[model samples]
Target: MRNFIFILTKEIRSYFYSPVAFVVITIFSVLIGYYFYNIFAAFSTISFQAQTDPMVASQYGVLNVTEFVIRPFFGVVSIVMLIMLPMLTMRSFAEEKKTGTIELLLTYPVKDLELVLGKFAGCMGIFAIMLSLSVPCLLLVAFFGDPEWGVIVTGYGGLFLMGGAFISLGLFMSSLTENQIIAAVLSFASLMVLYMVGSSSGFVGEKMGQFLEYVSILSHFETFARGVLDTSDITYYLLFAVFFLFLSMHSLESKRWRA
Candidate 1:
């Protein structure tokens, strides 16, 4: 436990020492803020149109401000995460390998799983901080409109879990290559595959479609976005994260023999 903490602390410091973490954070905050502004503008436009037209007013009468704004905001944030997380995670193990420091680190008393978990925790910690930067937007929503707090809570929970899965996959990808760009590209490709697989259900037969949706990370996120909070979705994310983490540990173990 002590060793793990030391490693985690080191990894966290590394993130701050480099410009990558700061860059990613800045880009994410700006984009999310812009996204919220767009949503708010669209909502305002809709409200204005409704006031001018009785038909439009009746059609939009059932639109809850909270649901109309917050849900789509969450959806777009999820998409932003899908794009930004790879940049955040690309250098985890790749940099070590590139600098030939991985060999030195492996000689330490630390176990492979400890190293993986320490690094994983460090990345997640950074991501959580980035996610917190969006809080002011949510607060704005709460102040101007009665956003559904329950839905907001569940959506954040889903985002965090989905991020864990992305980090785990990115870590494994980083372990496979010495070039950080290659690592980032591979991670993005892998994530895209997992993401796009969800759409396959629409093209395939019913039985296979259900299976595709079940396997797709986005499908589980949909339930959370709707405030459903099903155990199956929770379990899927847990297992997805664990599976990739285990693969990362195995990948690191292979480095020992290949060294």
Candidate 2:
């Protein structure tokens, strides 16, 4: 635990030195926030469209504008982060192999699990930093209108879990090659599949199509965006994170042997 925490902090500090990471997070947050602000403004306006049969009525009632409209726009930020995480994690093992640091680090008393976990923690740590920077946007939503704090909190919770799932996948892909570009490609491909997982049912039978939707990460996220704290959705996110982290650890273990 002590070593893990130490590595976590070290990894996070190292991440702060990367200018690309900062730029990506800043650009993503600003874009997503700006989009949501416009969405809310447009939705809240009492236009002729609303004066007649309202296009989007009841901002404060069920299917609240804040949850259905504004929150989902913020969710786009996660997809942007997913694309960038691989570029960052790709350097995890690949950089070590290129610079011969992995060999030196292994020569020490560090256990394989510890090293694998340290690297994973490091990736998650960096991602956490990126995610934390988006909080002020949510704060803005709160200040602009009566945003339900609970729904917003749960929505952010879903985002955090989604981030963890992608980071774990990225870390695993990074372990596959010494070339960062390959790692990035691998991560992108894997995440693309995951992103499309819920919608892939078009090729399946009707019964199985429904099943796929239930099993999909995106499907579970809808309830959270709607302010419904369903235990099933929470469990799905937790399981998704756990499964990918385990896969990442296994990838590191295999690399240890070949190294």
Candidate 3:
């Protein structure tokens, strides 16, 4: 636990001192803000429905456009993170190996679990920082129109889970190569496949289509988008995040026997 804390703190400090994390945060803020602004424009002064009064719900158009627009709006945000997370996490182990510092770091009397958790936690911290920067835009939507606060909370939570899963996947891929570019490419390719897996399910016949849809990250995100906050979706993301983190830890353990 102490060793984990040491590495986690060190890596987080490196993120703060480095430009990668800052760049990711800046880009996410701008992009999400732009997306939220577009939603406001599309809805205009007219709320989703004709609100005779602020308290009454109208039976006309959308009950709330916030969930419909902002929740799925993160599809783009998720892909953007896929690109950006690899760039940050790629250097986690790859740069160390490139500089021959990995061996030295490994020599520290730390267990494999400690090292792996530290790296994952560090990356997740950076992700949290980047995601938090979008809070202002999330709040602003409420002013222009009646966006459900509960829906936004659950929706953003899904984004956080999505980012964590991406971070772990990137970390595992980064562990594979000394070249950051190769790591980035491998990670991005994996993410693209995951992103497309759900959409392609519709084209396939019924037999395989259900299975493919079940495998997609998008399938789980639907609950939050619709403001359901289903526990099944939450559980799936938690398990998925754990799977990639475990894979990353296993990869590091395997490297111990390298010649």
Model 3: per-residue Cα lDDT at residue 153? 78
Please name the candidate that would achieve the greatest lDDT relative to the true structure: 1
Model 2 sits at a Cα RMSD from the real structure of 3.2
| Model 2: how far residue 197 lies from native, Å | 2.9
lDDT of 3 by residue, 1-259 (tens): 9999999999999987878778877887787778767766665545533565554344334555664567756666676677788877888888888999989988889888889889999999988888888777766766655777777778788888878888888888888889988998898889878878988887899978988887787667777766687887788788888898888788888977767
lDDT of 2 by residue, 12-104 (tens): 776678665676667766776677667766666643245554443343334355754556665676667667777778878777777888777
Candidate 3 achieves a global lDDT of 0.79
Sort order, TM-score high to low: 1, 3, 2
**Model 2 segments beyond 4 Å from truth?**
46-63, 255-259
* Best candidate, TM-score: 1
Give model 3's TM-score versus the native structure.
0.88
Candidates 1 and 3 compared: the better one by TM-score is 1
Better of 1 and 2 by lDDT: 1
Listed per model in order, the count of residue pairs whose N, CA or C atoms clash below 3 Å is 0, 0, 0
Query: What is the model-wide C-alpha lDDT for candidate 2?
Result: 0.72
User: Which wins on TM-score, candidate 2 or candidate 3?
Assistant: 3
Write down the TM-score for model 1. 0.96
Better of 1 and 3 by lDDT: 1
